[model samples]
Every structure is written in C-alpha cells, then in structure tokens.
Target chain A: MDRSMFVSISYFLTHLGLIFFMYPTDIIASTDEAYWIPITLGIIIHFIFLSIYMKGLSYFPRKNIIMIYLSHGKIIAWIFLLPVAIYLIMIIIITIRSYSEIITIVFLSNTPLWAIMFLLVLVATYLSSRGLDSILRSSLLLAILFLPLTLFVCFVSFQNVDWRYIFPLTTNDFRFITKPSYLMSYFSIGGVFLFIGFIQPLFTYKPKKILYTVLLLVPFWIISVYIPILTFGNSTVPHFYFPFVEAVDSIDINWLMFDRVTVFFLLSLITFIILFLSLILWMFMQIITTCIPKFRPNYLLILISFISFVCCLFIPDWKDVEDLFLINSPFRFFCLLIVPPSLLILGIRSKRKEKLENG
Target chain B: MGNTMIKVFFLLCIVLTSTGCWNNKDINHRLLPAVVGISKNGDKYKLILELPVLESDNMKIQIIKATGKSIADAVDWLSMNMDRGVDLFHVKLIVLDKQFAKQGLTDVMSGLMRSREVAPNAQMAICNEDLDYFFGNVQKSKPPTGDYLLDFFEKDAGWTPNIALTRVWQVYRSLHSSTRDVIIPIIQTGKLTEVEHIGSAVIKNGKMVSQISPNDTLLYNAFDGQGTQGIVEVMDLATVLILSDWKSNKSMIINEKPFMKSQLNLKVTILETKGNPSMDLIKKDLSTLITNRFHRMLTITQKKQADILGLGQTFRTKLPRAKLKNWREKYYPILKLDFQVNVDIQNEGFLKSD
Candidate 1:
C-alpha cells in the first residue's frame, strides 16, 4: 500500500491523457471562433485545481481511496463510492473507445474497431492484473521515454507558427467566457480523483520533493495546451477532430526524415493512452476486489474486461460516446469534489471525537 | 500450463500486431505537396499539386511539378493518379492566380481548410502571372525550387515583410468573421527572373478590394508583428533599413463616436548605408526621418482600413462586453493609426559604400 503512492502518481499522470478527449475541437469550434481564451483559462484553472488535488492527496496517505471512505461509515460511503465506482468505469470505457477511434481513423482506417479495442483491453487487463506496482513501473518507464518525443513535436511545430492568426488577440464576448457551463468545463481535471488514493503515501515524502514533482508537471500541461493554439491559431484550432494530434500533424519539417509527423506522434501517443486506460481499469478493479473480498481478482478482471468489451461494442458512434462523456462529466466532477473533501472533514472530525473520549 | 500457453499466444499476437504501422509510407515514395495551386476554369476548379520529385543525382536539389488534373472537378479528384498518396502535409504555400483570386475563391479556400490533408499553417498567396510559371521558375534560381519558395513564405530571409503570411485556416477564420475580410501576399516575378513579393491584396467579401505595396506592408506587419522581417526604404534614403522586429498597441474609445487608435513601433537596424551618410549623425537623423515616413505609411493603411494587425480581434478579446457591431461601418473608417520607427545602426559594415 505504501508503494501504491508510486502507482497512484503514475495513475494520475496516465489519466491526465484524458485531456485528449476533453480538448473537444467540435464543441469549441462551434461555440468560439478563437480557442486561446478557453485553452488558457483551462490551463490556469487546471493548475489551481491540480494543486488542490495534490493537497487533498496528503490527507489520505497510503491506502486505496475506498479504504479511507470505509472509515466514514458503510452506509454513507456506499452511497458515495457507488457513483465514484461508476464514474471510474465509465472513464475507462470512454478512454478505451477514444483511443481505438483515433488509431482507427488516423492510422488503421481499414482495421476493425473491435479488434483495436480488444488489443488495447488485453494489454490494460494484463497490466491491471499485475497489480499497481508493475503498472506504475511501466508508467514511469513510458513517461521517461515519451516525454522527449512530445516535446520534440512541439518544438518542431514552433517553426510553423503563424503568429498573425493569433494577433489582435481580443474577443468582445466576455459573456461567453463567464458562462457557468464553460467554467465547469475549464475546471474538468478528470483524473485528479486517482490522487485521493495517493495522498496517504505522498504525505511521507518531503513537501519540497512533492512540490518539485508537481512543478515539473506544470510545463507539460501548459505545453500540451499551448502548442495547439500556436500551431492552429485560436479560431481554426477548434475545427480539428483531435486538436492535439492535428496540432502535431501541422508540424511538417520539410527537411526532416519523417514526412507526416502527426502519424508518428499519434502512434507513439497511443502507448501512453493505453497506460491511461490501464490506470482507470486498475482503479475499477481495486473497488471490486475491496467490495467483494472473497472473489479472486483474476475472475474480476475477466468480468471487467467483458463489460468494457460490451460497452465498446454498443457505444455506436462519436456522438453517443460524446453524449455519454458529457452526461457523465458533471456527475464525475460532483464525485471528485464531494467525495474526498467530505471524507477528509468527516474522518478527521470522527478521529478528534474518539481522541476526546479517550482523553 | 495450457492457460499459460494461451495467455502467451495472445500476448505475442498483441505485440506483433501493434509493432509496425501497416499504412506507413516511406518519405521517398510519398509525394509531399508543398505548394497546391488551384485555379477556376469556368465553373470547374483546376487542382495543381506541386509535389517534390527528388533528383537521382542529389537529394537536396529536387524537381517539383503538378501531378495530375489540369482541370479536375475538385482538388481531391487529382488524388487517384499518385502511387502512394499526395499529401499537403508540408504545403507551406497555396498560390492562386490573380484572375482566380479576383473571383470569389470561397470554395477552393474551404476545400483546403476542410480537407485533413491540407495543413492549417500552409500560407495563401496570389501570383501576378500564371502560378505554374512561379512554381516552374522558383527552382531555377539556386537550390531546390520548392524548398526555396517554402523558405520565402517561411520568412527565413528578411526580404518580403508585410507580405501577409495568411494561412488557409486564417482565410477560413476571416471569411467567417463579420468583417468578411482577409489579406494574401501578392507576388510578382521581377525582370531579373527573381520572385519579388510586391504587396498584400485585401479581400472584402471574398473579392479583391484594394492592394497595399510592400512598403505599406512593412507598416502593417510592424503593427501586427507576425514576427515578419522586411526592408523598408525610408522616403528619399538610398539604402533600406531591415526591420528585424516590431511591436504594436491598439485601444478603443467610446466618445461621441467610437474610435480606435493603433500604434506600430518598428525596431529598424541598418543593414547597409549606400551613400556617404555619416553612421553616427545620420543614424539619429534616419530615426526621425523614418518615424515620419512610417507615420505616413500608417496613415494610408488606416485610410484603407486593412485590419491585418487584427485591431478588431483585439477589441473583441479585451473588451468582450463592448458593442462592436458596426466596427467596420463606424469605428474602422475613422480609426487613427500611428507608426513610430526607432532606427539603430547596429552593424555598419567595413567601409560604408558611398
């Protein structure tokens, strides 16, 4: 469980790949002509809330989030944990399909979607079954390997930046930005829920090391959002199907050995996304294993994989996938905001009460 | 052991299947279209894909030409003839003939933007003569022609400043905007057979309304600072100061009548002084003289109401709640633009040529 902090942090970063789906170019394009404000606002709000999530982590040290929740009371925790468990599964299912969708559309257009999903799920299930430790080790390996490629794509794209498009960087529609729904979308740090399980172990580490690790992640988030704006301009950026991939695609080093960089980056990024899927799947499995302690985790893994397969088969289209994601997003945010904060307050209060009685 | 063998078989399949890309094309086989020229012949749009054909002798020096379709129904119609696939992934320049540009090019513009193949950053331009001529002759000068043209549009050389490096995506944005305006560089090859970027063409409602020369483009770019570099010849000066960098500011005022003031500041470094102009004394003199000259240039750009600097967008972003409905009608017409050039003779080469 102490080693789970390492897994929790890796799981946290893996789930950060959820930003891929959240970068909805279609929604952004339809609503706003320029994407700079929303992306900038999203990053700033993300930074603020990511810090909050990391802070919340310290309160729960080393145990799985469900363990911490159980301390509150079976009845209240069950009510709360049910929605969180559902949300985690839903994220896993959506992430599974989104990756399949990208690989199918961009690279393997002729390949069957089921085949892609099956291949991805097989890898994820194996990783999840290995338990969190190996998954975290692989994730750290992936992070070390892929970070340079991501940065290289961004740097290469800088040469192609047409600043004229972003110039006169003004929009008269403050009302559009101030909309409650938009701000909600801006604060959608979807994967920070994984951190609830992390706080327990991370608390043992020095505050400075934790802060430094978090600070390192800040630039990655900024660069992730920033490159798309610089490459596609604010207005056109939203039109891209996958704005990040499209952003990388726009980087054409005429002299470079590679011609279509987006394709290369997309293929490489899929591995990271698979790791992302594995994190969510791991969390879902953890909930099941904890709730039904007598059931073997291997049998549970098969059941989860089967359920995910069925979900992928029926989700039907991007529109349906999007609808499910949208419907689930607010509910998921509700789970993230309410569950951990509530547990922290209640658990601490109960602890204080017991201490007083003993005294 | 049976279960272990089955699991091992599945793992092997996953590893083998996901390793190599099935559709990946080698760089050599793929025809990378750097400049896609589309022209309108009657109702049909002729698609000309200028793809690089690497030389058998040297990779650096390559040949480029149109793959197919002298007059295809659409640009995508020409994709059938290519071996691997024609991708505009590196397409930095989209050249339109003057005649094609004169007629509304909304369809071709939309086609380039909508197609996933065409890059969003690929610049849009209008050539004075046949675009084929420009594409053909571009390589004849020195290095590989396609790369040379790409460099020109890339603004690596500080030669063509203010030649609005408007991309296909930018055109889509401008066309969709309420203003219904966009700017594209107007290029004309000189008598010496060298490509000369003359100025920028202003389009209103997808039709060419006015043209601003390269000198005026300098003033426009200085205000916009697309980080574009170009040489601006001060009124009577024999030499031109290469503008390395530029900065601009704009404001909207709500008085009796709404007005916008735009200021463009250019940092001009002396590239060469042709006549015996004292480097020490004339440097100060040139700064004042250029400032006045730049002001005159801005006065013309303002009168023309070329929003290349995106003053309209600035207002839209900064003061989102403000009523900007009639910016073109009321504010832009009466908008005042001021230009100030600060000249510094950074490198005065050995023996100032007189």
Candidate 2:
C-alpha cells in the first residue's frame, strides 16, 4: 500500500478505536455541560501538535524518529528511544486490558477476562509479527469492509437521540478546558499522531496528506464524544463505563436482522482496536530492532508479547486500569511533548547538514 | 519437526477450547418470555413470565408466576424452578400493575437498565387491572401465534397512533432527564379485543403522577411529534384524518417567566361530517377543539408538575446550570404556553370540495 493509504488507515483505526472505547468516558468525566468546549480545545491542540510533527517529519523524508535519533548518537538515542518504546508497550497493555474489561462487561459476562485479553494479544501479536506493511495492508482491507458498517451504525443510532441534551451550550466554569481529564483526552485523540513519525520512513512524507487525514478525523472525534451525551444526557453519561457503546446498544434498528446493532458495532470497533494494538506492537518491535540491530524481529515480538501478557494479568480491575492511565499520563505527555520538537529540530539540523555536505 | 508439532498442539488446543459459542446456552433449554408483568405485594414483587409455546396444532403460552423481595430474586426463583432457564432477552412487553407504577418503578427501572439481557427498546406499559387477573385472562383467551401481548405494542402489527409506545430506555432517559417525563400507555383486558388501550399513565420522577385518556393521548402524540394518520373527531361537526408537525419557540421569556409558543401544522382529509360544514368552518372547529384539548392536557400536567412534553428541555437551552437545576420546580409551572394551530385541509376524498 502507498503511504497515504497507510497513513489514513492507521490514523482511522487508532482514533476510531480510541473514540469508541475511551473518549466518551474521558469527555463525560472532564466537562460538566457543553462537552463541545473541551472537544474543540482538544481538536485545536491536536492540530497544533500534528502540524509540528508533520513539519518535523517533512524535514527528513523517508526517515523515522529512530533513524533521526540514531544520527545524533547511539547512546543518547537509546535514552530517547527507550522511553518511546516503553510508552508504546504501556499503551498496548492498557488498551488490551481496558477493551477486555469492556468486552467482559458488555458482551461476555461469564467468560474469563484473561481469555479475552489473551485472545486479543494473540491476534495483535500475529499481525505485528507479519510486519508494518502487513498491518497497514490489513487495515486498508478492514477499513474498506468495516468503516461503512460502523458509520451506518452511528447514523442509525440517531433514531432515538434527544438533541435537547446537548443544550445549555455554555458552562459556568471555563476552567474545565484545562482539567486533567480534558488534557487526558489529548492522549486518545492527538497522542496517536506520534506514530506518524515512526511510519514516516516507510513512504515519502507528505505533510499536506497527513494534515488532511488529521483534519478529517476531528469530526469523527466530536461525534464519538457528543453522541452519547446527546442520546443519554450529560447527567447520565458518567454513569456508564462505555457510554458510546451503550448509546449504540440503545439504538433500536427494527427492520434490521439483529435486534441490537451494538454487536455489529462492537465487532467493527474490536477489529480496529486489534489493528491499533498491532500497530503499537509493531512500533515497539521497530524500536527494539533499531536499537539492537542483531536481534531477530520474530524473537523480539514474542518477548514483547510475553511481557505485555504478564503485565495485562496484573491489571486486576478497571480501576487499576484507570490508575495505570493516571500514572502513564505524565509519560504520555512527555513523549507527546518531547518527541515532536526533538524530531523537528533534528530534521532541521539534518537538512542543513545535508546542504552543507552537498554544497 | 518439533516446532511444527508444537504449533499443531497449540492450534488443536485453541480449536478445542474456542469451539462452539462464547457463552453457549442451548436454545431448547432456555425459556424465551415474550411478556413480563410485574406487580407489587407489600415489600415483595410478583412476576408473571408469559412464554409462548408451540403445540402440535396451535400456538399457546405458558405463564409462570414467582414472588421475591426484588425483581432479581423473583427472576432467580423462576430460573431455578423452571426446567428451562428463564431468559428475558426476547421480552417485548413489560406490563406494570397500576399499584406498582404508583408506588414508583425506580427500582425496577434501574434493575432493567443494569441488565444486559433485557433489550433497551422493549416496550413498557401499565396495566389498569390487577396483573394476576390480566395474566389469567390472557391465558384463558390465548390468541393464535401466541404473541397476543407483544403484538399489541408491535408497531407493524397492533399499534395505532393513539397508543403511546414508551420503550425501556425512554423510560430510563425520562427518569434521568431533569426536564423530561414519560407517558406509559395504560392497558387492560377488553371484552371484544385481546387488550384495550385505556389511556396513558403520566410518570414524573419514576412514579405515576397523572393519567390521560386515549382521546388526549392522540393530542399528546401530536404535540410530541408522534401523531401521524390519527383520527380527530370534533363533536359532530367533522371527522378528519389528521397528520400534524409542530415547531415551538422555547426561548420566549416574559417578566422572569419562561414562555413557550407552539405552532402545529395539521394536514387534514375530512373523512365524514354531521352537517354540511364548509372546509373553512371545519378547519376552525378542529383548531378550536385541538387548542382546547391541548390546553386542558397542559393544565393537567402543570397541576401535577409532570413535563411529559419535555417543555422544560426547551427552556434548558437558555437557562444556566443553576437555573436549569431548579427549572422543574421554579420555572415549569409558572411557564406560559401559547398555541397556534394551522390546519391545512389536503383533500375531502371523492367530494373534492364541500
């Protein structure tokens, strides 16, 4: 697949999975009334960070962050790249644990949690082992198949929506825009833009294409957050664990074969989440292999999967998963803050150095 | 060879463990209840599970009754007693006795909301008569296909524009929505029909606050935007088949009192008439009749403080959070309503003009 196809599909899976599973809870927890306030702020911050990241990547065409960092010095690069690698691994663990908890609660009440987690990690590991090209290829295929189905589900879910719930578009406290939960939403929405750097080397980097992909994703983010608040009022959104999923469940598609379209919705979302997990795992493997060039990618994947599996087991419950997010927030912000600018500066330096050498 | 053998073993293990369904419950061993009637007896709850059964010749239903301190307990007791486990996944109709609804359905509503098995769109109604008597009558007069109770609320089959179709999630939303209330259709066993639509039980804060007759339910549906293909008879002046759409300006404020002005556009086809009333006169009569009836319904709801039309939700847009919090108590009753009804007579059937 081409870079545009890869970038768009990867971006779609990453953001859509996050929106479906995590964004509703985060948005409801963050703001009181007029969720659009925090959402708009989040989107602005996302675009700012994305433009900088894309500009940095544009400096070094066909070179990933690992390559750029490696040029600085291997030891210094290890210090920088190790944290990024750990962040990717942590994201994989957290996503797997959180989604498994949702699956257990919503779909499979009787099935053991570890079984679901194991199955998810297993599939993600297999896809990741096949390499990034395979992951991107499968994403394109899955997006083609499931994106329309997911959008149609969202469209039909408007049947029972009470638009009045979105009213009182003003809030008493404007400071909610800076709240921790609101900031945390950036992790789900914009934080995934960091992966763009990792995949930059795979194809010629085009800033406009990537910018367009990010722009296209903003409405999806807004819809995923607000639909639940619109369907079940702000007063009620905080009560459910996965309000968006429940909102989809609340839709009554009478003429459709299935009484509840939520199952179809979950299946599509789960596919995206799996692909997202695969992308994360692939990123982690890339970091590891880049650092230790002698290590086999297959062995490194098994090692990463094993470690993630063990880490997933330790997450006893959803609250612990939440605490994990709180603990990881600073690290998430650190990577989100540090990697883009560092890459931008490096990209600039590399370009100047290249001009000097060529001249 | 060893690596291939290990992979084969793992594949076989996965295939063995993951075969069949995720949570496999055999269909033959599960009882799919079509209608569940809940009534309160002191602190305990009486549950009647109506399951449709197929005999050699005709369709019949098996009614199972159980009692417990809570709905869950009753369900567990029923599950234990039946040869086939009771599954409420397919439950289409949830009938609550008048006493149960009056006492407050907060607990039952919360329980149903928490359960994954119960579909959110399952239709809910309030039985005017005792549930025991209703279920007994339903058993005695078993209609063919055995979906007698389900068909009553099924829009495709038995539902009319007059019947208020309140789903479980709608009831839950109403309970949570500060400005909104729900109208559950009140039903009873009829002499001629299997079930009768008596009126609607107006629920405020999860309890039945007031009742509206079926005649008022038509206007209620019209105001709430569900009225289509409904018949409106104005005394003996004219019988008109009416379809209505309404738009309301909820931002109107007059001297610290919230004001709502609604304009209802009614498309009418005059079906029959007692006198040779001109189309203009018939339109005027319908306008008067609907305006009066709507005002009467509004007055009743205001007296009861039940915002069944969700008029408070409209005012919610203008009010800040604090004022919105107190809207139902402070602003709702004092709110003034101005109704403007516009009737457009589409056609008078074969007689093009009267």
Candidate 3:
C-alpha cells in the first residue's frame, strides 16, 4: 500500500517548519536587494539534487536508501552513510537544543531547558519507535489540524509589510553566493528532501512531483525572508536572529483574544518540527540497524534518543548553537550535493549489469 | 492491562509537570507587566515595571522599581525579590527617559533583540519627565491596569496623526537603517487628563537629535502614508479635515549632485470657510498653507541632516546598493528638494457654497 499523499504532506510540513527559524536571517544577511535571486538559486540546486536522489532510488524498487546502498557492499554502504549517520545525529542535537532555547525565550522563561528537551525527545522517540506507518498517519492528522492555522498565519504575516521596501528590486551584487551565510541557507533545504529517499516502497512518490511541491513552496520561502525585509527593510532585518518570528510578532490583529499570534504560529511549527524529528530518528535507526543487524531495534532507538538528549544538554548557549550550524554545513553539502548524482550513476551501472546478465 | 498502564503513565506526567514553576505557572502566581520603563542615572540603570494586580476583576496597578547595571541585571534583582516570576510577553509599552534617548539606545535595543524576552512590536515613546515621576503620576490617574498607558498610542483608542505611534522594532530599524529615521511621541503627565502627547522626538542614527512640533508630526505621518486623515486648521481661509488619503509623486535624479522633486496631494472637506469664496481661491489658499508647513518641516529635516521625512527611501531606486551605505551623510547633505502641494476640495459643508 502506497501513502504518497501522506509522504508529500509530511515533506511540505518539514520544509515549511525549518524555513521560519533561521533561513530568513541567513538569506537577508547574505544580500540586500533582489533576495529572490539567491532564494531561487538555492531552490534550483535543491530541486536538481532531489530529482536525482529520487530517480536513483526508483532504480531499486521496494528498497529503502540504506538497503539499496548495502546491496553493493557493506564497506561501500558504511563509507557513504557514516557521515550521513553523523549528520543525522547533529541535526537532532541542534534542532532539539535550538528549539528548546527558543521556547524558553518566547513563552516558557521560567522552565529549565532540560525539561523541555526531555519532553521533546520522549514524544519524538515514542512515534519514531512506533515505525513509519505511525509517523505517516500522525503527520496526516497534524497537517489536517494545523495546516489551516499555519496558512492563516502566513496570510496575516503580510499585514505590516510595506511594498515600498520592495524597491531596488535588482541589485548588482550576487557575491552573496560565495558568502558562508548563503550556503547556510541550504541547511533548511536539504533536511526535508532527505526523508524522501528513506520513505521508499512504503510510499511511492514521483520525483517530478517535487517540482509542484517547490512551486507551492516558493511563496513560503519568499514570505519567510521578505516579510521581514518588506516590513523592516534589509538594513533592519540583519538585527534579528529569527527575522520571521519577529515579523510575525509585529502583526497586530486586535480582535483576536490572543495578545500574540507568534505564540500560536510557533506552537503549530513546533508540532511540525516534532513530527520531523521522529522521521529523522526513524532514518537513523534504519541506518544503524542495517549496519549491525544483531541488536534489538527498539532498545537502539531509545539509546540514540538518550545520547541525543545528553548531547543537547551540553550545548552551553545560543552562540554554541550557531557555531554547531557552521560545523554542520560541510556535512550538509556532502549529503545534499555529492550523494545524489553519485547515486544516480550507481543506479545506471546496476541496471546495465542486470540487462547484460539477462541477455 | 497495557492500555490502563499507558493511561496511568500519562496522568502521572500531568501531575508531575503541573507542579513545575519554570514555565507553566498559575496566572495568580505570575506577574504580567503591561508597561516597562528604563532610565539611566550615573553608571546604574533604573528599570520600572507597572504590574497590574487582579483584585476580584477590578483592576489596579502596582509600581515596582529596581536599579542595576543593565536591563537583565535589573530584572534579575527585581525578580529575585518578588514571589512571582516576571513575564515581559504581555508588555505593550516601553518608555525611555529623555536622557536615555540622547545617550543612544543601540545597546539596550540589541540586548532586547538578542534575549527576545520582550516583543519588538511593543509601542515605544520618550518621556519628557523623569520615569519615576511619570509612572508615579500615571498611577494616580489609573483606569484599567492591564493596558493603561498602551491606550494613549493604540491606533483604535487615542491615536491621532499628531502622535507618532512608533514601536520598538521601528526604532531598532531606524537605528540600523542608513537613510531612514523614526520619530517617537514625547509624552508628559497632564493636569486634567492622564497623559499628554506633546510632540515627537526625532531619532537619527539611534539617538534623539531634535524635537518637532506635533503639527510637523502630522505631516510626517502623511508623508509615511499613514494617519493621513488628520484635521488641519488653516488661517483666514477655512478649517478643513483631510477626507482622502495621501497621493504623492517623488522623482529623484542621480547626477554628480542628486536632486529630488516631491509633490503632496490631499483632498479635504470644507468644514468652515471665511466667506463664499471661489473654489479656485479656496484651493489656492489651502495649497499655500500646506506648502508652508511642508517647507518648515523640510527646513528642519534638511538643516539637521536627518532624513525624518523618508525622502531617502524614494531615492533608493536611484542609488546603487553599494553607495546607499553613505546616503544620509554623502547624498542627503547635498540633496535638493523642489516641493509642490496640491489640494482638492471634496465638498462644502451644508452652510457654505462656492
């Protein structure tokens, strides 16, 4: 049974959740005018790699990414996926640490950070161990409950935007491409597409459908960065760490009982992030269990989550969180840039070998 | 049996989590301040918070004050002393003393940005008097404590074009922006009323450089394309209220020396006229009056070299992005304005005919 609809919905949710946090700050810090240039370029690169990743996976029907890699040789699989495994763990540690810090600052100032981290890890581990079916079903339910509210927040985020800030539509400097901040924006893009390769036979998805998904995503990417610039120009956008969060906070709808719509917007995004964490954990388990087949999988899941929780506890402050992102960017490029085209080549070779044998 | 075990575990978590004070706390045990004030004396900073205690639905405010080296330090001192935790989430207003406004707010503003304890959208104003005096007098005229001082600038409540309704984020933007400056309303305690909005304090490059009369603030608001419906009392011809929005045309020429032409258009309803004057005559007199106000505003902004009118924003299209960094200094000084005003009379009152 294929759950492509559910897979696509979760893919959209994960990407949307990641965009609002740090992507806007990085994009704005990278360029002054015509932000669309950098944003579109990033998406084009992501689209090319994603199309390749999916096409490569399609060569081996009904098999996940780890299994497909291991079919060649255990050394080959381990060599390719050890960094993938490390990057996945880094993603968990950073996301958990950073999001918990945000929650403490935003609404729960009195609470200890460890408690929030524990709660997040516990909930994410519960669904991760329940397996992919539970993850997919819960995501469908989450999108149904939270999608409308999210769409409503996105619409109202423009309430404070000044179209005048959209002036100087074209700027001369595309040197933003070489800046470290520009590549950091890719961290947001690479995360949501990785799971697409992992969800394989359980949910049959078309690579070309990523074009439609990206078309739908263009407005979100634009709004996430542009809302801050359009509300408070490029000069002012750099002052914020999460410019989109502040932009959403600037929206004033008095008739609503809630004093801050940011709280509501954040609550929904946090749920999406949790759903994403489960998927990442599930992916991590799939990789490790394939490498060492003797260990019981459920206990392994609990152990990885425990290690993640302890690692999150060690991040001293927000500055360390940012430094960790800089360190992770290299792994991100390897996973996003190198792995895809290489996989497609491998798939082509495997297919040619099979045809020769049959003939 | 497994289902019941899961049920008990969930209930136990709720029971254990409810007792934690770090985040989840009872409303009665938490302090939600509506307005926070900051002023500096010598090397120390004084932080003022107006907390509204809910006494059986009838609301009133309690004033709390602390002194420290920074905002966080002051808050720490105060929070340590109080039984309840302080939450800046509901803060609707932040008032800075005149002295604090001059000394520059970049440090304090960035501190707020980094911590993000307070929402950047909170309405901000400069107090003409001491903050202690301002809040002490403010308490005597208390109405409801939850959003007491916020009503003075809330667009729906007491806001008029004469009052420059600036926010923390706008001020922070002005601090960083190369060409744009923000004006925040300057307020003082009133004798008959609760508080009086005197005028607006012009903030340039993160510091208060000059003050403009409230009339000029109305023009500033209209130029920014907000609160354009403010009433204007023109001398000897008529008293008219702006009935339509602002329609402006600005053209910038970027030669060796950049120059600009600015046009202001307003449609007004004739509330009172001197006599049965010709429509053309009335329009001419109104045009002259508005042109004169614009001239006064321009003379002040140009002389001070502060781009409070946001003319630089219009010229952003004319300058390259790299050259825009020095816009206020290099370009703004040598820039010239060819100003024009156009007034359209929408209608006459019942008693008058042209």
User: Best by TM-score, which number?
Assistant: 2
What TM-score does prediction 2 earn? 0.95
**Backbone Cα, N, C clashes tallied per candidate:** 16, 0, 3
User: What TM-score would chain A of each candidate receive against the reference chain A?
Assistant: 0.85, 0.94, 0.97
lDDT of each: 0.62, 0.82, 0.83
Pairs of residues at least 3 apart in sequence or in different chains that clash in candidate 3: A110-B22, A111-B22, A111-B23
Flag clash pairs in model 2: none
Q: What's model 1's lDDT at B245?
A: 59
lDDT of 1 by residue, A321-342 (tens): 7676666766576665665566
Give the per-residue lDDT of model 3 (tens digit) for A117-230: 888787788778788999989989999999898999999998878777888888678899888888888878888677877877676766666657777887898889889998
- Listed for each candidate, the true contacts retained, as a fraction, are 0.15, 0.56, 0.58
Per-candidate interface DockQ score: 0.18, 0.57, 0.49
- Evaluated at residue A29, the lDDT of candidate 2 is 88
The DockQ for candidate 3, computed on C-alphas, is: 0.49
Candidate 3, residue B311: Cα displacement in angstroms equals 1.3
The candidate, 1 or 2, that scores higher on lDDT is 2
